[model samples]
Structures are given as C-alpha cells and as structure tokens.
Target: MMSSIKRLLIGRPLQSAELGEQKLNKTKALAILSSDALSSVAYGPEQILLVLITVGAAAFWYSIPIAAGVLILLTALILSYRQIIFAYPHGGGAYVVSKENLGVNSGLIAGGSLLVDYILTVAVSVSAGTDAITSAFPALHPYNVFIAIIFVVFLTILNLRGVTESASVLAYPVYLFVAALFLLIAVGLYKIATGQVPPVLHSPVGTPVAGISLFILLRAFASGSSALTGVEAISNAIPNFKHPAPNNAAKTLIAMGSLLAVLFSGIVYLAYYYSIIPNAEVTVVSQIAESVFGRNFMYFFIQGTTALILILAANTGYSAFPLLAVNLAKDKFIPRMFTIRGDRLGYSNGIIILGIASILLIIAFEGQTEHLIPLYAVGVFIPFTLSQTGMIVKWVREKPAGWIPKLMINATGAIISFIVTIMFFLTKFPQIWPVLIFLPIIIYMFHTIRKHYDAVGEQLRLTTCEPSFQIEGNVIIVPVAGMTHVVENSLKYAKSLSPNQILAVYVAFDREEEKRFKEKWKQWQPDVRLVTLHSHYRSIIQPLTKFVDTVEHKAREANYQVTVVIPQFIPKKGWHNILHNQSSLLIKTFLLYKRNVVITTVPYHLKK
Candidate 1:
C-alpha cells in the first residue's frame, strides 16, 4: 500500500543514463531561458492599464512612456545580470552574487526575494491566463481558480518529465506570440496612418489631466515595471544550459532581452494607440482586439495568441522556480529534499511545491491579476535592488582589466534599479505592505531552521575520546537473533563493557525454534548464560518489550544497573525504510525512558 503511494507521489527512480547529457545546446538553452521574458509581452501592457484605470482613460496613454521606462530598466538589469553569468558561470545567480560580495545574509535576502518573486510569477501568469481564457469564453470566469489549478498540475507533470521536453513544447507558442504581436502592431499602425482607426475608449474613470502629482506618475511607472519581473529568470537558469555555460547563458540573455524589448514596446504602443482602457465591465484584451480587427477572424486569433502566451509564461516559472530552489538547497538555505533531482534530473520537489503554492495564491486572490498586482512588483524589485547593489560591490572589490568600463555600467544599473525599487515601495506601500511584512517572517523561519541544523551538526562532530564509563554494578543484556553478524557484533561489544554478569537473550514466538536456539546456545558457548522468552502471539515488539521489562525489574531488585546491547542492521539504500518501518527506533525510544540503564547499538553495515 505504501509502495503504491510512493509510486503515486514521486514515481520510479531514474538512472543516471536516463538523464541524458549534462550540457544543453545554445538553441535549446535559449528557448528554456527566454520563455519567461518573452511571455511577459502577453500581459505586460494590461497590468499597466489596470493601474491607470484608477485615474481614467486619458491617463492610459501614459502607459507608453511607462513601458519605455521599464524597457530601459530591463535592459540595464539584463546587462548587469549578464556580467553575473560570466563571472559566476556555475550559476549562483543573485544569491551567489550577494554572498560573494555583500555577505551571506545579503545573499539570503536576495534568495528569499527571488523565491517569493518566482512564486508570484507562477500565480500571476497562470491567473492572468485564466482571465484571458475567461474573456475569450466568458463562462470560465467563475471557476478561474479551478481552471488555473488544473493548468498548473498539467505543467508540473510536464516539468517532472524533463526540462528539454517542456522547453520544446513551449518554444512554438512563444515564437507564435512574438510573430502575432508584431503583426498586430504593424497592422494596427497601418490603420492609424490610413485614418481608419476607431474612436478612443470612453470611461467613467477620470482622465490624465494637467498638474497630476509627480508621485502619481512615479506610481504609474512602478506599476508598469511588472513587465520586468521575469527578466532575471535566465540568470537563475544558466546552469541548465549546454556546454560553454557562460557563452550560452549570455546568448540566451541577449535573445531574451532583445525579444522582450520589441514585444513589450509593441504591445504597449498597440494598447495605447487603440485606447484600450481598463473596463471592469468587459475583458480588456478582447475589447482591445475587437477594436484592432473589426468583425474578422483576427480578433479570435489575437485572443487565442494572448491566452497561449500567458499560459506559457506560467510554464517559464515552472522551470525557473525549481532550479533556483535547488541552488538554495545546495547552499543549505532550504531542506535537502528540494535538492534531490527527479527521474528526469530536474528538481521535482521544488516544482511541485511551486505549483501548489501558485494554486493557493490563485485561489486566495480569486484569479484577478488586478488584485495581485500590488503584491507583485514588491518581490521583484527587492531582488533587483539587492543584486544590483551586489554587482556594484563586485565592481569595487575586483578591479579587472576593464574595471573602469564595468564599474560605470554597474553604477548606472545600481542607481536605476535602486530608484525603481524605492518608487515601487512608495507606490505599493499601502496596499502591498502586507506582502513585505510576511516575507521577513518566512526568512526568519528559514534562518531558525538553518541555526538548528548548524547546532545539530556541531553536536555530531566526532572527536578523539575513549569509550570509557564507570560501571555501577552492571548486568549486561545482549539481544541475539539466534545466529547473525549483528548478534556476533553485539556479543563482542557486550564483552568489552565492564560488567560483572552477562546474559544472552532470545525471544521466540514458536516453541520449536526457541527450544532449538536454547540447545544451540549451550553448544556454541558452554559457560555463557542463555535465556529464551516465549509468546503465543506473533508480535515482535510486544514480546521483546515485555521481556526487557521483566529483566529490568529483576535487575532493579538486585540493585544492579542494566546495560542492553541491541544488534542493528543498517540498510545500504536510503529508501530501505519503506520496507521496514521504525520498529527498532520505537524499542530504543522506549528503553531510553528507563533509569539506571544504558542502551548501546552494535550496527552491522550491509554491503552494497
């Protein structure tokens, strides 16, 4: 029964050969890395408009400038992270950067921030896709969470199968999205030039009037920066790329950055040019598509493209989150299980955890991208700020051959990222501070676990010390399994201890075996005492436990300390616990409660 459950959760173990080659080629690596950044074009404009809707239709035009600023920031961030990939080609990413320059605590902050951002990336992208589908069909709106969860489960399975397999599946959709977006932009611009464009969208919400505060404008730009969330995903995924890790990673980043810039710029321009305003009354993307291609199949095509892109964006998070987590686990920041690779050599535990967490967020936020937008950029910018700062420190400490040039770049990137991070905090503080509050609590919990692990490790470190103890009237009890290596080892250990008396114990459920063992004991050791306890019931723990109690009671009456030597066989495989539960553990735990008793384990290692 337990085997069935194990098979259901983790499936079969994968051999090393099944994992294929360690290196991923440039093309495949680019596909895997660019997925998140490219998918950003699908909903990036929509998120900006969702924020501007509070002010009104006229303010929606500002999305263009906002997107442009985000593009600049993203480009700078990509270049800064590119240096990171080259410097630490082993794929430490932000965590590595901060650790090497800033300190371990700084690295942890970057790690925690990235972890939260990846989780939110999955949630926001999947929920946004659900919204797009609901807009296309209108019927799925009520069950968005359920639909999103189903999608996450499907993607999780794909990820568990293999990274290359999942990447191949997503590559086409991402390419199609890039093509369709450019086509829409070109076609929409032609219509505007020909004076065939329709009237601008009218909204009851206020317009972008003169004298709007600088605070409001900064807020708008900060909200627009959600498009930049997935830019660093490539850096986190560098290790998964094929041979010449740095070169492939750098190329992938360039492709991702260039593609993201074109797609994001086009989407923002098209949305603004078409006057796509936030409508709580209607789905914004569909409404915008309808305006772009009136009464034609192009509308359905654009809508379909958008939905596919958003779903694929969620898939990007599915790949990245696990790899980042695996890196964290290797650094001892998270549980070791997360570091265990799946049958396909991917971080299966991390992927499943990410999928489940995303599903919960979808449910909690009710699959509304607008509702989650406040919590979104906070995590993204936290890592951005830390990573850029770390890079600046790196520039200072290591004065390379091109030190002046790199320092200038790092300084510029740091200033830009730092300002954006500040803007995000200022704009998102009221509605988003709760998320910030919760993150530190999680970091603290992880820190506590790390501290505990460190303490236990310190305690377990072996030192040169003799196994000597003052014997206080000892009567040693050795448990024998009739004849086994473990029994022989137990007798040897028992004889080493300074005991005035010694007795060999054998408990048997069958009388014939008990009688045979008693007769054999006399032949084996003529002088050594042997005793057998019998029970009609075939229960190993209960019979042995009762016998130990009887012997302890007699030893207490005789005012002698009892030293029990138990022979334990250690399995070679880690999964051997599935074959045998904690029977020996239970007996040892029960015996530890007794006063004036010492329980020693004589372990026999099984050969692999």
Candidate 2:
C-alpha cells in the first residue's frame, strides 16, 4: 500500500536505458541549473542596502557602485567557470579540479564548501520565496516557516521523479520570473525617462550618520555577493546536459550571467531611484513591483512569479549536491550510500539529505531570509577561489593554446575571490563564525573517512594470501518454538543443506509447555536430535546464542561449517506484521557479525 502511494506520487521506477532520454536541452537546462543565481535579483541588492540602511537614507546611493563591484567579480567567475566546464567535463567542479591540480586536502576544502553552500542555497532560496509570498499576502506571514519547509519537500519530490521531468515542470516559472522582472525594469526606466519618478515610502532624505566608509562598503559588497551563489552549480552538474555538455554548459553560463547582470543592475537602480527601503516584512523586489505597477494584477503577478522562481531555484542544489557526493564517495572521502542512485536515477540519498538539512535551517533561523543571507555566500566563495586557482594551475602545467589569457582571467578571479572570502569572514563574523569553524572540522572528517576506506581496502586485498581449495561438510542448527508447520518448514529447509548433523533446539520459559513440546517432538521424531535449553531469565535469543556458541566451538574442531536455519511468519495484512514477536528477526540481528556462523531464514506466509 505504501509502495503504491509512493509510485503514484513520484511515478514508476525509470529504466537505466531511459537515462539518455532524461538528458536536458539548453532551455530546460538553463531553467533548472541557473534558477538559483538568476533569482538572486529578488534579494541580492537589498542585502547591500540592508547594511547601508543603518547609516541613513542618503547612504543608499552607494549601493550602485558596490553592486557594480559584485558584478565585476561575477564576470570573472563566469569566464573562469566557462573554462572549468571544458576542462572537467565529468563534473565535480571545484573538488575535482582542485584535487587533481592542487592537492586532496585543498579538494576537500573546496568540496566541503560546495556541500555546505548547496544546503544553504536551498534554505536561503526557499526562505526568500516565502518572504515574497508574505509580501503579497500579509496574512501568510505567520506561517512562512512552515510554508518554506513544504516548498523544500515539494522540490525534493519533484526532483525524485527524474531530472528531465522536473525541468519540464519548472521551466515555465523561471521564464515567468524573468519576464516579470524585465517588465518591471522597462516600466521603471520609462517612468524615470519621462520625469515621472515613483513615490517614496517616506519623504525627505534623513541626515547621514556614520557615513560612507571602506568598512561599510566592503561589508555591503560581501552581503550582496549572494547574487553569485549558484553560478558554479552548472559546472558541478555538467552531465545533466546533453552531449557536448561542456560547450552547452558554457553557453548556458554566459546566458545566465548576462541575465543576472541586467536584472540585478536594473532592479538595484530602480530600487535606488524609487527610494525603496529594505525590510524583513516586505522584500525589495515586492516594493519595486508595487511602486512600478501600482499594486495591480501585474504587481501581484510579479510577486507570485518571484515566489515561484525563488522556490524552484533550489533545483540547482538538488542537481549538484548528489553529483558532488558521488565524486567524493568514489574518492572514498564520504559514505558509499551517497553513490547509490534512486529508482528514478536521481541521487535519492543526497536529495533526501539536502531536504532535511534545509528544513532544519529554516526552523532554526525562523525562515528569515535576512539571517540566512550571511551564512549563504560564505560557503560558495571558498569553492570559487579554489576552482579558479586550480584552473590557473591546470593552465600553467598543461599550457593549452590560449593559456596566457586564460591564466590571467583565472588569476584575477582567484585573487578577487580570496580577498572577498577574507572580507566575508571578517564583516559577517558574528553570524557566520559557526560555519567558518565547522569547515575545518568537515575537512578533517573527509580525511578520516578516506583513511578508513584505504585501511579496509588494504586489509581485504586478496593479493596478500595464496589461493586455497578446501571443502568441508556442514552442521545445521534449527531453533523451534513448537511442533507447528513453521518448525516443520524450518527443519525441511535445514535438511536440504545436506548437513553432517542437525540439532533442533528450543528455549523454554515454562516447564509444562516444554514437556508438551518435547512429547510432540518425540512422537514425530523421525530424523534428528532434539535439545532443550532452559531460560531462567526468560530471554529467547540469549540462551539460544549460548547453545550455538558451544556447538560452533566443537564443530570447528571437526572442520565443519555451522549454519543456523530460522523460520519467519509473514502476515497477509501489512499491519499484522507487528502482532508477532518476530523471534527469527531477533536471532538474525544478534548473530549477523559472527564470522563462524552463517544464518538463513525460511518464511511461511499466513493466509489470515
């Protein structure tokens, strides 16, 4: 019943042969891959003003120049990652680039940063989308946290259906958002051109206190760097694209980067021209829409589309995290479970994990985009710097045809990124200190897991020992609760093993019940020996394990293998499974790690 519900919701399991069909075209790929960075126009500019607002209303003018600086860095990263796509077509982005060019430790730093950033991308994007909804309908503000979590769950289910299917569903909302913003920008620019400026929320610019300074400028730039957060996602998931993934991805990168620059610049300029104030209750984009469209259908349309696109932006993270995890797992740095794909060919483990982590962040931060904004870009910068540096190393070592120009571009990005990373840590230290502290710890964990996997491989390698050909007879043990068909089935399965000896053991809690069982066994006894174990503590598995240990100790002396056969009862109804004690399950669970004991089960299905 549960599986039926799952199949209904997420669709049927997809075949491996259909994976080629799952590959995305450039249009669908742009929607799913670039949504996070594109949607940053919703809040990126406001993050700049959020820092500048404390000074005074007059200080908002600095936002334009600071935004331009962010764009410069964004341009460098775009060009750097275009090269990254062609260089590492297999994906892994910064992690693979740094590991091969720099060192494994540097690769861990890049991978760890990317991992944390993907999780934060989901949290920050969903929370901002919730803020958009609350701005449109003020009454929903109280439930924004809950709504954000539901958004994460919805995206998880959508992605779990398969990548191609989700891209088709999500592509429209992204185009809608871009269209809304383009309309907003065109209208606002026309209004300004005709000398019909929009009204302000408050009149008369206030006095400047603690006015423009280098510190505030740097802080605002760091905060607004959220605009560049998900640009690396496309490079990280190159395989999601069609054949010639690198060329296709690089083109998509240019398209996404161009849209981001125009939308971000136009929105920030309009926000400044209209004197929109940054606030938690209402977003900058919402305010811009209200001022430009007079709170009409177009205004609500903008808000609705903004919310939808922002929520869908998390698709970038869903696309990248599993691919990154697969890279780490193959290198033996993380758990192998992350390497496993779901029924739909999506990385189910990574998707589920990213969902849960995003939900926790929403709850912890109370779904406020402002608080999550500080922790957002702090993660991505490390990867950005390392990826560029790795690219520089690649160019220096390989010296391709146009190596000098490529090296200069990556060098510029690496230098800019390294400085901004330091600034982010310093400017947002109070809010982001926890994340900075946890990074080294995550890197340490990566090293430890890699070492453990290496140790296991070394110990398990067959090259250390010579080949042995030996055959021996088997001794089988069957534990019976009574003289029922279940016991008969268990014994029948045990005898099929063709054992040297068979022992049917029973753990009795009551003397009277034991006598009756023994009498029945004796009457029906036509083949094997029956032994009884008395349990004074009334424990079934404990007394049974003791008897098996003694039998195993003697069996090894005779060069015989011991096999334990147990019987399980399966009910017709799913809920009826809880009605039995499940003794066979308990025995198997306890004896699972024993090197000398082999355990097997014979299950009998009950009609009622």
**Pick by TM-score: which candidate is best?**
2
- Index of the highest-lDDT prediction: 2
Write down the lDDT that model 1 would get. 0.75
Candidate 1: residue pairs that collide = 24-242
Model 2 TM-score on a 0 to 1 scale: 0.95
Q: Assess candidate 2 and give its lDDT.
A: 0.89
Tens-place lDDT digits, model 2, residues 363-471: 9999988777777887898889999999999999999898999999999999988888888888878888978688899999998999999988887898857455333
Q: Which ten residues in a row have the lowest lDDT in candidate 2?
A: 198-207
The lDDT per prediction is: 0.75, 0.89
Model 1 lDDT per residue over 1-608, tens place: 77676566545666778665644676666665666667666666777887676776677667767887888788788888888889888775788888788888888888888787787878877777777778777776788888888888878877776777777777777777677777877887788788787544432234446555667767777777777777787788877887677888898888888888887887787677777766653555577678778647887787777777777687767767888888778766788799888777888899889988888888888787776766776777777777878888887787778877777766777777777678877776776786667777867866887887787777676753434444447788876766777777778777777434788877788888898888888887666688777767766667676777887787777677788887888898868857876555766877787766788887888886
Q: After best superposition, candidate 2 residue 312: deviation in angstroms?
A: 0.7
Cα lDDT for residue 185, candidate 2: 100
